[model samples]
Target: MTTYICDDPVDRRAGLDAATAAAARGELVVMPTDTVYGIGADAFNSAAVRALLAAKGRGPDMPVPVLVGSWNTIDGLVVSVPPVARKLIEAFWPGGLSLVVEHAPSLSWDLGDAKGTVMLRMPLHPVALDLLRAVGPMAVSSANRSGQPPALTSSDATAQLGDQVSVYLDGGTAPIGIASTVLDVTGPVPRVLRQGAVALDALREVAGEVIGAGQPDGA
Candidate 1:
């Protein structure tokens, strides 16, 4: 595993360069995000996406989320963004919210078995954002085995992923130990699919009358 300590300016530059190289090689990379460490591969590269799924032992039916550098990158991926969705994006993007929307038909890449929906998020971490900006859209999911706890630190990610991933960007621990809250906005009403870093009440503030995923605590 190629590891770099991101505490220093020189190391940070090297780390980003390493991550860029890994992505260009179509190799899976584990890097820290605001919420959790994510395993990433080039989103537009079919072979890279497949390799990421295989590395994680993820099945073809489970689709991974894509992490973009900024909100501008989202428009080309999703077919349409509802007013409420746009509000949420404006309010909480680059933070800890992931929105699942209808994918644009023009998008040619396949992420396992994503059906027609694609989850998009712009993480708030500088290293993650820089890497995404350099590498473009990346097929990213929590760096952990499927059905297992998400990795909160670079050590956790390395333990779970090992050599299966080409490089592990040790950007220290993540700010949020849990995954980002997932919201589905493809329908008329915005719904919470999973509650994590972002709270239900917070989502309702922007979405107004958000429904939880059949859970008692969902807002």
Candidate 2:
């Protein structure tokens, strides 16, 4: 496995080239995100996405999230983005917030039991965004085994995933303290699934009355 410590003025082109090349070949690439390091593979490649799940010791029951470079990328994958969702996306995207929305019927990609929904995030990290723009959407999950604590750095991820990954793009320490907050935006009202970096109070302020984590939509 090859590792690139991108902390000290690394070349953006080099990082993007290496990451996109590896991802295109159905290989795993570990890279830093706004919250934590993520293990990434082409979202549209089932084999690559399956391989990513295998390396992380993940099963097909839990769906993996996709990270995009911009709002248009999300629009392509999902059938619709509600007006409320649009407000949240406008305010918190390119930051830590993952929205679960109904996938476009025409799409054929599989990432575990995505069912009819897809989790979408647009990270604020530069390296991750560069890779996403160059490689397109990626099936990105926290770079650790399914139940393990998320990796904060490339080294931490390497220690866990090892050579199962083809490349590692190290961008020093992570800036965010927690993973992106996950919310289900597939229904009439947005509902919180997991509260993390983007806290509930902040979400409530921006989104008005969002359903709390682990509770019924109107609870």
What's model 1's TM-score? Answer: 0.95
**TM per prediction:** 0.95, 0.96
Worst 10 residues of 2 by lDDT: 7-16
Off by over 4 Å in 2: 10-12
- On the 0 to 100 scale, the lDDT of residue 214 in model 1 is 75
Model 1 residue 129 distance off true place after TM-score fit, in angstroms? 0.4
Report the C-alpha lDDT of model 2 over 21-100, residue by residue, as the tens digit: 99999999998999988999999999999999998997889888999998888778878877888888999989999999
lDDT of 1 at 87: 96
Question: Number of the top candidate by TM-score?
Answer: 2
- What's model 2's TM-score? 0.96
Residue 119, model 1, lDDT = 89
- State each model's CA lDDT, in order: 0.88, 0.88
